[model samples]
Target chain A: MTTWMRLMSNDGRIVFGRVENSYLHEYESLHAPVPTGAVLSLRTLTPVAPCAPGKVVALWNNFHALAAKLEKPVPEHPLFLLKPAESVIGSQQPIRRPAHYAGKIVFEGELGIVIGKRCSNASLDEAEAAIFGYTIVNDVTAAGLLNENPHFPQWCRAKGFDTFCCIGPAIVSGFDWRSARVVTKLDGVERQNYPLDDMVFTPAQQVSLISRDMTLEPGDVIACGTSLGVGSIGDGATVEVSIDGIGALVNTLAVSSGEAEAAAAVEGAA
Target chain B: MTTWMRLMSNDGRIVFGRVENSYLHEYESLHAPVPTGAVLSLRTLTPVAPCAPGKVVALWNNFHALAAKLEKPVPEHPLFLLKPAESVIGSQQPIRRPAHYAGKIVFEGELGIVIGKRCSNASLDEAEAAIFGYTIVNDVTAAGLLNENPHFPQWCRAKGFDTFCCIGPAIVSGFDWRSARVVTKLDGVERQNYPLDDMVFTPAQQVSLISRDMTLEPGDVIACGTSLGVGSIGDGATVEVSIDGIGALVNTLAVSSGEAEAAAAVEGAA
Candidate 1:
């Protein structure tokens, strides 16, 4: 398995490269591995989200373990949601809570399939080939927003805020994801630990089925739905979503004081 | 009301301009009007979607009339869903049916709020200032996908196909939306006729509240949810969504042959 990452180097140059033994071997492109002969220490660079996605298509209940645990029937097709591209953040970015929303925020750890090619109406084999790599995703949600009104669940609003989606560490290719497991930790305490083998739909099947619904372009991400052990996070708590082969994505949660104050001032004026 | 539109001129150039008296006055940017001294006949240009949005935040039950009609309670907050940017299409673009989905597709005609600036945690007045203009939206949905699996409603999948969202004709600024009405017709037969004043939340309130949920960027669209008379569209049927101030957005629905054949072949092979 090879690890790919986008990072800002010591010289302030943003580059895409491969990580090997804590050193980065800069590459010209992810599609064609033409080495740029620029090797730098990984510690000398600041990591960013591996790829800039145009859109993130996230799943809701594509896990067998979660379905059985919830006593819900397995879905015939993937139940998915769209997380706006603006919500995306890198590994170390803080998950800023909405100023107007004071509610329980939860972290969902799942594997993200990064599309490498423009895929439309692709067959199973073709879909398999279209997958470039996998990365860790922290699909943070304002849990209280889901049942606040009861008339309708605000899936997009509950999850679409800026910095709600924390993804990265690195995108790893050629990894055997079937054996991988998602282990989530909050404040250094283990919470969710689920196996990828318990998925209702395989990665290839998901790619093929979803591609039929919409075109999946290069850098587009498909977040495989999370399993059980999902729980809430308090302000100032550090959450880390880890996968064995992919690596760990760590982010801190906090309420924005400046924005909150600005909102309150506006409210008072009105 | 001031109308803004993007059109392809007879000289084979796509230009963003002000639409006045069946003539196009070309402008460099949407924020400021810097006339390029190029005025072309409106008939010489093909009209496109008014603005290029990064994301379209669409509402579900923000209409009082429809909620009351459906026997549902009014939402405390705007219950919204996201339509991926890839789903967006200009007026007159055909709504291509998903190859794998052989189901009912319905159209929800509503007013679209276009954002002018990057706004978050804005007050009512700030939100009002952030609104650039209004347009018409045909929020098309794959109706059958909603309840095919009873566990979770596939809102994103139901509406996330390419060309599912038809928006445009023009973005009319400084329009009196309170007296405005959305009139939808299928095959030239009137179907839905609803008043914008029947909305649970006003445009400014929706902007203020939704901005608190997430940052509304320039050119971002928030579809003010639809009212009653949402129904299905037959294959090869022409559907139109019209607002009184903004022009009508018309599109045709058709089944995709090549993609469907490819999917069927894969199914047969499996």
Candidate 2:
């Protein structure tokens, strides 16, 4: 089933369902449930790419397993990483793997926190107030590059390929973390599953730690690290990364020429 | 004299001098020659910290004499370096030189660009439109940090100290660069001066070259590298870096208070 979001009016007077299109709610229309119509019919279908984060400051590997794979102990401090801003995609969108990435592409399912408030050096107690909500992230990894040469410099060129990261659905404002779960699938085969509580580091600590170095700006994204169930998607494969409390984001791998053409044409014309 | 900004309003008229009182801009009455007032007149100046960029991409040895000092050929493309956002400071700010920074600190004066748009692989022709305006930047350098120690990471721990980079009194939207000059002074003695055209890499090329691999976001910053004639400010000295068409940024070097207690209190109170 395709998943969408609902939110209460700021005054908490009414519930609005089948809100804005895509999942990240920027503009939404309040509507009652329709007996049988696509979520598009809910409104004019003002769809959007997922939360267009101002910047995606990711952690290299906040997960213990990822640490073990890299032959390191849990970090004394959280590592800083970056994925380009253009990487986010919403539900039903394809994961458009770039041909340059070819065999190196892999998927990492992660729980991402969406910052609602500007926060810096936020304490564990102040963390909740700073978090506007949480969303699911497919922290797609380019293992082929790592497999080719595990080094720091290659990551930007590797992980920053146009569609390497896809985040989706509206943020669930108050997700219960204790038993939250994440699952990744390729063509309906479940490849990974783990309870959120299983993480060596907690979300509270993640916020508290990251705030130490950089002031977390509003709309700055923080992607929780992924589990080990990562693999390359064969050409033309359909992939889905889902979180239990929220929703699933399904995407296909393919080349994207039209957008580049559009940008080129726009530039040329301008 | 305190510097103030003048920006075009939505109606296409010039609006000038809004005191940034803690994030809220309180509109002021005058435009010409910045007004003078006691620090107490404004409730609290919005800590206009130097706009710490997500990245500090610098060009290496772009200056002629500096190129000779390093015994390296001036690069065909701008050689970029990264500075953590922690290093930036705002108007009237003080830069603390920790004892840990073993070498003498020198000042590099350059034209600073405050990005107002996000562009990837942007052409040189599109550089100006991507800028909100231009400001003065003191690209403070730590000779001890990386000078002879080639293994040490450039700028990160050295130039990326708290308050190392300072920008502004105002962001001048339209400033001529063709016949401009930049100068750096320590106390009453002029240390460095060079015509704007002396630089090996032009600002337009700097934007276009760096945008090839990475994205430049709105509010991101770039400090055009300083020219030759850098001299010693040594210990316990005050330095002023300025451009002919723009204003000057003066700062004194001292030690910092760790700020951990302040951060902790701010966190607890956030």
Candidate 3:
């Protein structure tokens, strides 16, 4: 398997590279990665999300284990939501709590499928061919805002805050996902450990099914739904979502002073 | 007041220009439009969406008339959904029906707020200053797919299809939305006639309130929700969403032969 990464060089230029040992061998592009012979130590560069997605489509409940736990039947299709690109942040970036919302913030770790080509109404085989690689995603959300209004479910708003979607480290191509597992930890304590095979719809099925609903562009990411052990996070808590083939995606919840002050005010009022 | 438009020149170059009587005066950029002394006839160029939005945030039940008609209370916060950038299409572009599903596709005509600068946690006054212009939008949706699953409301999937969001004609700066009315016509017959003043949240208020939820980038669009009349359009039907200050955005529904064949197959199976 090949591991690809995107990072900022010491000279402050964003470049794509192949990760090996302690060095990142520079490459021209993700689709056509021809080595540029400019090798840099991995420590000298800052890693970013392996791909810059035009859009991020996230599944709601695509895992059989989760569906069974919730007592919901298997969905006929992939139920999904579109998260704004503005909500994306690279791994190691802070997941900032919205100052205006003094509510419970949660962390959900899931496997993210990175699309390499433009896809629309693609067949299952075409969808399989379109999958470029895989990465880890921490779909951060403001849990309290989800069901606040009974009339409409605020899926986008509850999860579309800045720094809410964390993706990164590297994108691993040709990696076997069926036998791998997604392991999530909070402050060194293992919170979630689920097999990727528990997914109701495989990555290819998701790509094909979702492509019929909307066009999936190059660098677009489809985050497979999370299973059990989804829970809230406290301020300054660190979250790490790891898949064995793809490296871990680590992020910390950063509750700003303004948010803390607002929370205090709301608590005082209450 | 300035009317800005984007178009594909006959020479096959994408150009931004100011719309005058029957001509387009070319400009260098949308943010700082420096005239290029190249004037082209309006009929010579093909018009596209006035601005390429990074993301489109659309409201729901934001109109008093619609809220009262549906017997729902006015929301404390804006109920919004994010439409992917790929779904955006210009006026005169055909709205293609998804081939996999034969569902009731509805049209919603609403006022669109174009953002001029990156805004986050903005005050009401700052939000007012950040408003670059207004435009007309036909927020198209597959109404039948909205609540297909009783548990999950597929707002994004139902409305995020390719060419589902039509925006354009021109972006008019300094337009008076309060005194304006959105007028929609389906195949030359008027259907929707609603006052913009009946909105629960004004443009500035929407910007300020939503910025608190997520960062609003330059060229981001906020679509004020539609009111009263909303109905599905048949294949090949023409739709025109118009506001007084912004020109009318007209498009026709183009159902592909593949969709017709699939519909027939489903009917035959039934």
Q: Which portions of model 1 show Cα errors greater than 4 Å?
A: A9-14, A21-44, A255-270, B9-13, B31-44, B258-270
**Best-first order by DockQ:** 3, 1, 2
What is the C-alpha lDDT profile of model 3 across A1-270, one tens digit per residue?
989899987788898888899888998877666799999898888988888887889888888989999999989999988888888888898888898887899989999999987889999999999998999999988999999999999999998998888998799999899999999999989999999999999999999999998888877899998999999889989999999989899999987898678899999999
lDDT of 1 by residue, B1-270 (tens): 799998876777778888889898998867665899988888888887788887888888878888888899888788888887888998988899887787899999999999988899899999999999999999999998877877677788888898988899899999999998999999999999999999999999999998888888888999998999999999889999998878899999965786567779999999
Clashing pairs in 2: A94-A252, A104-A144, A116-A132, B50-B89, B50-B90, B58-B81
* Model 1: how far residue A249 lies from native, Å: 0.8
Q: Over the stretch A1-270, how does candidate 2's per-residue lDDT look in tens digits?
A: 223343333444222233435332323321222433323333334333435565565666566766687676665555545566656666666776554334556777788877766666688988777876677887776665543432122444456545667777656666776677889898899987877776666877887766654566665678887767778776567778788767786777764465566679999999
Candidate 3 residue pairs that clash: none
**Runs off by more than 4 Å, candidate 2:** A1-52, A82-87, A94-106, A140-165, A186-200, A229-238, A258-270, B1-89, B93-110, B115-118, B128-133, B139-165, B170-201, B212-220, B224-239, B251-270
Of the true interface contacts, each candidate retains a share of 0.85, 0.03, 0.91
> What are the runs in model 3 whose C-alpha is more than 4 Å off?
A259-270, B259-270
Winner by DockQ between candidate 3 and candidate 2: 3
Cα error, residue B220 of model 2, in Å, equals 4.4
Residue A246: error of model 2 in Å? 2.1
Q: Give me the chain B TM-score of candidate 1.
A: 0.92
**What is candidate 1's CA lDDT for residue A59?**
86
Ranking by lDDT: 3, 1, 2
Cα lDDT of model 2 by residue, B121-198, tens digit? 678878766765667777777766543332223333345545667776566556676577888888868887878777
